[model samples]
Target: MIYLAARAITTVFLLVGAAMADRTGEGGATIGSLSMRWDGQWYWVVATAGYPADLPLDATGHVTQNAWAFMPLYPVVARALSFLLGGQYPIAAIVVSLIAGYVACLALYHLLHARIDRVAALWAVALFAAGPLAALFQMGYAESLFLMWLFLALLALVRRRFGWLYLLIPLMGFTRPGVLAFALLLALYGIVRWRHRASDPLPARQIVHIVALGLLAVVVGFSWQWIAGIVTGDAGAYMKTELSWRRSWIGDDGGFVPFDGFVQASAIWFRVWGLPEPLGYVALALLVVAGAALLLFEPHVRRLGVEVRLWCASYALYLLLVFFPQSSIFRLLLPLAPLYGALALPRHPAWRWSMLGVGLALQWWWIDQMLVLGTTFTQIP
Candidate 1:
């Protein structure tokens, strides 16, 4: 019920934002159109046109932004759903996101309930459902669907249900670009279980399952690159397509370099805002330190259990390594939803309600900036 209400409230915000955008002469300002904005349009292209065998190139002979950067699962599912809706891909895409978002909420609640009290879990769901990026719940983005798979995968991991992961990991890997983090989590989890074997039982069968699952995740994570390479006859096709987006901001920083995105982004962003470049590096270091401390030392975060903490750590490291911090950073951080359980730990009504209120306010701000009035490159959601 709480989750439903939160979605309803976010829907109202989206509708109002759409109406406002319509008045401001924004192109394709209807609710359906707004839902399909930004990356939503890319997914639409993927669903309708399908990925090209030949990569699109610019005058400079560089890979231009194309559908290959997007994974196939969400749009493919939306395309199937569209057939049932008389070929209404937009409506089908939104429906897929809405349903997936609700299921993700349920999975999250259950995941948190096992580690914290029922009330805290509910509060966490409330916050997650009405979060600043909650708009993704109704939009035609793949995020909600990806989150659904991710939450369920985490639930399965927490309960020692390794068999479910055999199915979920592939779904997760195809749905989004974060399954490698899950692979890392499995490796860390196996080590932790091995170290605690004296007190907690670590069976040989479970060890085999963990090792196999880890290997599967790695294979699935890199499978898309191989698939793209095979189809395009260029092993670097997927990597080049992804780097094309970074080029728009950083102007072709050469080949893909792990962990260099953040460094380059930090300096670039700070310089854009009229700040010293050195401070950006210093700030990046501080941010990394702060994140590590929160995962290792924070008491409330500890209560969410090792699996959740490991996931948070793993996903954060993944982002630091591959992702360039930009406007979409908030959207990318949605996988860290489990950490909301820690924020909900404070039992004060004032604190909880205030958080919800602030979340809704930020949701409106995010929608207005990224969806309603945004027209420039920096406003990419």
Candidate 2:
């Protein structure tokens, strides 16, 4: 409890400090104001008012932004909490995220300790707590809620508690689109255990149960789109709304392409450097693929356990394929808890401390840019 409190309190201070700086420089703003500034604003609107019945469209008939693109679980909880708190959605959402962040750290620490030594586990928690974009913990974003549930789900998986999946998996899907990685990880884990049946301790019947649960988890993970589609009376409502986030930025009316972010980034770099654009794209593609392969197959990563390895691999691939390489990608990757395991590996004391120092520095840097200087539309937290 003390450890968890420390992590939570420290995160709160970092965020508050950054908010103070923003207020001082931007003619004053409350911490609550800072909390609901960006995506939190969207959640606040959705929670209080609910999503529109139609996919919002611009004058040009292009799909405009809609809250339906965001997941429902966080907003639903925030709405309930706000009702109890006299209808203060921002405060309610921040409160939910703050509490969830602390609990997530606690569960994450225990999860890591189950696989590594206490010292290493502690180090992993430190790294995560002070990581770049860690300030997201204090925001009204769903990251904390989603991560807490995700860590608890992972803990349940490590303990072979299939019952938790029924609740946790669905909540995860309702929290973030990234839940697909968890669904895939569970399926892959079942497959691995089946292939190594002699080494697997679970009974054959339990194996079947696990596989069945994994399939259900996948269905639940993807159920939100269908749910949204039904509500909006448009089968493609979810996709159209989500694609609106990038359609104008990438100018890609073409269908989804694998590694689309890489292609856009490569073109941007080429414009800056005067290099052949395709050459840049090819180079970035090779580097990303190589780096992913290294992390997936690295001995240190493998030691994090088969399930963690698979989750990291699937989540990393999902990011590469779907997400653009923007500042927000750092925040999006925070749920990849297995990366902490790899970071916790035994290393020189100086090396470990140095990495911690660098992480702290970057955390503050991110807080300043995304929270303090970002009160305007200059940066996305």
Among these predictions, the greatest lDDT belongs to 1
Best by TM-score: 1
As a whole number from 0 to 100, the lDDT of residue 150 in candidate 1 is 97
TM-score of each: 0.99, 0.90
Give the local distance difference test score of model 1.
0.94
Query: What alpha-carbon RMSD in Å does predicted model 2 have with respect to the real structure?
Result: 2.7
What residue pairs clash in candidate 1, if any at all? none
- Residue 111 error, candidate 1, Å: 0.5
Name the runs in model 2 displaced over 4 angstroms.
Answer: 1-25, 269-276, 375-378
Over 158-260, each residue of candidate 1 has an lDDT whose tens digit, in order, gives 9999999999999999999999999999999999999999999999999999999999999999999999999999899999999999887988778988999
lDDT of 1 at 122: 95
